[model samples]
Target: MARPQYILQPVNPYFIAFSLAAAFLLNLLPWGKLPGIPDFVALVLLFWNIHQPRKVGMGIAFFLGLLMDVHNASLLGEHALAYTLLSYGAITIHRRVLWMSLGVQAFAVMPVLVGTQLVPFVTRLLMGASFPGWDYLVSGFVAAVLWPIASVVLLLPQRRPVDPDDTRPI
Candidate 1:
C-alpha cells in the first residue's frame, strides 16, 4: 500500500488567531530574569513554518512582529523586519529542518532565532539608545531552548491520523 499523502491545507483563521494570542500570552508571562529561554513568538513562527509553511508565511510573521512592536512599545518595524527575515529563512530551510530529529532542529534554529533578536538589538544601538544589556538576548536563547517543547506541543494536534473511511471526502 502506498503511504498516505500529506496534503497542505489552509489552517482555519480561528486557529491562527488563537496561536497568535497564545504567543502573546507566553511573551507576557512574568518570567523575570530567566536566561536562555526562547522567545515564544520565534518558537511559534518556527513551528508554523515547519508544519504549515503554506498557511503561515513571511506575511503573517511580519504582521505579528508589527503587533509585538506596538504592544511592547518599541520602535516601529524593528520586529517586523526581524520576523520577515527569520520567517523567510525558516521557510527556505523547512524541508531539511522538518526531516531532522527534534534535537537537531532545535540546535539548527538557535542561530536564526538569535540573529532575529540581534538585528533589532543592533538597530536600537545605532539609533543612540543605550544597550538593553546582555539579558536582551535571553528571549532568543529561551526560544532555542524551548524549540523541542514547542515542536512537541504544535505537533500534538496532528498526531492522530484522520480516518480515511469516514464520511468526509478527500
Candidate 2:
C-alpha cells in the first residue's frame, strides 16, 4: 500500500510566537533543579527553523539565546553561538530532514542538537569551568527523544483544510 500523503499548509505567525513563548516558559519551569531535563526552547526553535525557515532564522536564534543567557545567568553568547549554529544546521538540511519519517528525523536531529550543546561545553571548558558531568549530555538525548512529539504538536496548526489553489490531495 502507498504511504499517506500530508499536505503542507501555511502557518500563522502568531502561532509560531505562541509556541516559542510556550517553549520558553517550559524552559523556565522549576525543572532546572531536576537533572536530565532538555532545553525545550532550543527544541522548539530548531523545529521552527526546519519547518518555517522564512519566519525563524539565525537572528531569532541569537536573540532567544540572549534571552536564555539572561534567564539562566550563564555566560553571555554561549547559547547565542550555540543557537546560531543550531539554526544554521537546521536551515542547511531542512528539506532533507523534513522528507524523512519523524523517527528518522529525530535521528537526523540528534547530531545537530548534540553539536549545539558542544558549543557551550567547549566555552565553559575554555573558561576553566568544571565539567557539568555526564548528565549534561542527557539534555540532547532528551531533546532528541522529544522530537516526534514536538514535530506533531508544532505541525498541528499547519495541517488545515487543503487550499483551493493547490491541487494536491490531503
Tens-digit lDDT string for candidate 1 (6-81): 5434456577668767987887777776666566887788778877788889999998899889977899999899
lDDT tens digits, residue span 39-92, model 2: 898899999999989999999999999999998889999999999999999999
- Taken over the whole model, the C-alpha lDDT of each candidate is 0.80, 0.89
In candidate 2, the residue pairs with backbone N, CA or C atoms under 3 Å apart (3 or more residues apart, or in different chains) clash, namely none
Error of 2 at 45 (Å): 0.7
Best candidate per TM-score, number?
2
After superposition, candidate 1 runs with Cα above 4 Å error: 1-13, 30-37, 163-170
What TM-scores do the predictions have?
Answer: 0.82, 0.92
Candidate 2 Cα outliers beyond 4 Å, as residue runs = 162-169
State the lDDT at 10 in candidate 2.
81
Kindly give the number of clashing pairs for every candidate: 7, 0
